[model samples]
Target: MPKARAITIHRHFIEPGTDWNTEDFNFSDVLSAQGSSGDALSITPNFRAGAAPENAVGGGNLVDIFNAAAEWWERAILDDFDLTLNFGWAPLGGGTLAVHSLVAQEGTPNRETEGTIRFDNDGSSLWFLDPTPDQNEEYQTFTETTTTQLGGGDINIGRVYTDPVGDAIGRFDLLSLAKHEIGHALGLSRANRSFRAENMDFDIDVQAPRPFPGTEIPTRNGAHLTLNTSLMFPFFVTGERKLQSGIDILANAEISEFNNINLNPVHVPEPTSTPLILSLAMGVGTFVKRKSLKRQSGL
Candidate 1:
């Protein structure tokens, strides 16, 4: 690794979709608190017979769940960068990972497809679209949302980005998606690979060879797409999520060049508690289904 100047990468978490409390207070106290529905409160894991459960059972917020996701990944990838990365559900200068409301972008009626962030031509800036700011607007950052989880479906499919591992039920897991997209935003792209950057080696792992039925793995060169996979494997499998061993190294290398930093910098979120250091069964989504991310779309 070559040495360069250190740079600070600003990380913004945008929530165009549902959000937790704009600011944190008490979660448990909100149940039976009040409402237009006037329904009684019960935070059981099962779905109740009304809009209340779908909208406000337990009053759990995806925003806090996402915050925790950022926290886990940030802690996991802090080895090589002199990072001052900040993660928040606000509009800061740094690149953003946004989630928008369905009505905002006139995007697609399909709930299954959420594109990644849109970047500028210079590759110097990017922001998310959705949670429309106005009828004719592109986006409204962090719109007040009330979308909550209904847990206990195909928990492993990675639909909801908030479900935790070993939990009785599941929702979409956001760790892998957040980490992967952030990786792209920071400097993981086909362009960098084509540019002959060392990190793009895509090396194959021959040392830690695995038995059949094992998750794909990558070495320093490239991966045997069929044999093993990593976090950046180009496709996310249902219930799948885990950072590859070598992906972080490439991140460090790329950021070193992009920021002219002594190291490549990336940010996850700082954990408010002990995190589960386990791999998720990565998911397959519109973005992951594509053979590769667009030349520079970053989506």
Candidate 2:
């Protein structure tokens, strides 16, 4: 039998309105590749200094929204893995949620700690650059922002568009934005050929489906993932009132599978030379016995 594997999550929510998104944004279901669920990678609900609280529209608190998002992650991933999410209210100096940690902000002055800010998606299309240009070399970036606004008579959480004219807009619920940022934290800056190298965040200037010379490649678990329904998909919320459906399902499955593999790894046998050692030991013992008998007989 293989040993059981376990995991624990420790997360601190980025102060509300922190500018974590850059050239592009990444969104994912809450579960890890294994079916574990936790708030280890979630953000706080209340707007911090300078953040516009007038934009949040959902009728719930941070705990409720986070729990709902965590459930979604749990459903997406499979069972058999340990997952936990810890809630925290500590502040952070702006950093990357999906690519790497926070870094210095240039070009655009860092916005107020918690208020409306602009996203830079102009260079995001470059993420798809291919070594060899071809007919299939195309790229696009999906970017948006979340802020508070007055809607239907009260303050609400709403998404502000960052795409250029005629570019598609992605509408996300507040919880959805947190989920997206979590994907970035997991090192998904842009979609790539395989899940093992999936960089779904917006930090890079590369795009997906580039002209790489190879057939479809499988993930570390030997499974091939299609663009649609992949946890690494760039877009999160769409239209109004619709959280990305079936996210928890994927997160749960991935987390579970990862844990199973870790808990039960394949074992390779030792070398085939062990029996030779035992045979040599028996030959030495027999020669000793014969010598002792000859000495007894005075031969």
Candidate 3:
């Protein structure tokens, strides 16, 4: 997870015009891997700014933004656990459907193989569909597969990580987007319309969807605005980085299982040059019970 013994970044899936082949680029440079001072979730984006968007505000250095996003997650949730993320890079050629496309492969004890695991495919690969007002890019759907035991928890076989946020038009925060996707890869899914039950988003099993308690957050201009606290919320505004309590509870429970894993993960080099390999062991990623998506009332 920390180091990609061997990694590469291929072209992304495209529509209408030209789709980048999945074997276009290979990344050896580790842009940022800071779970907390040591080896944590990483971003290997050393390639030129070609992958970055034109309207990019950070001097077009997507690498910095991406790392910060990863770092935020590290601090917010998975920081305690010595986790390593071998990121697969796909420098933005143009505006794409999704910014990040990940495949979370879960493997349990008896059935360590990914295919063997039961997937609650809602028929759609989108874990979290955003409020992308622009409506242009078409990364469309995302899926998951394969499995090999990684320590204790499931290794998120992040097939391909892309960015949905456009450089200039995208007011989305880097950490916000990364955290949202990472949530799914780490067993979190879009809290359906029926997310909140008894004021609990997951309630051990995902329930009806309910907008998390909105906090009065201040804008840069000193104006205050209310933003939903649920990180798993479906609709995405420009800058939303609130970590809900329930998600924390779930992720914490998941992390406890990893306590059995060695502080440092053993790097298993892959045959393919470009691929993020993550496998969840039995107690965790198995028996994925998709919470019924019964619409509830909320914003």
Which model scores highest in TM-score? Answer: 3
Against the true structure, what is each candidate's TM-score?
A: 0.31, 0.31, 0.35
lDDT of 1 by residue, 1-299 (tens): 54332222233333334343323311110000011111111111111111111312122333333333334334334322322222223221222222111111111111111112211112211212112111111111111111111121111111112121221112222344444444432333332222223334453221111111121123321211221233443443323333322333333333323222111122223333443333222332101111111121211
**What TM-score does candidate 2 get on C-alpha atoms?**
0.31
Which one is best on lDDT? 3
Query: Candidate 3 on 1-299: residue-level lDDT in tens?
Result: 45422111111112222333433322111111111044333323222212333333424233343454444444333322322232322433222212322222323311000000011112221122233311212221122321222222332222211233333233443434444444433333222111111124223221112111221111110111111233444444442223232333233223222222111121222322333434443344422211111222221
Note the Cα lDDT for every prediction shown: 0.25, 0.25, 0.27
RMSD of each: 20.7, 27.0, 19.5
Q: Which scores higher on lDDT, 2 or 3?
A: 3
- Over the stretch 156-246, how does candidate 2's per-residue lDDT look in tens digits? 1111222211111232333444444333332222221223333232112122222111212222211222222333343433321222222
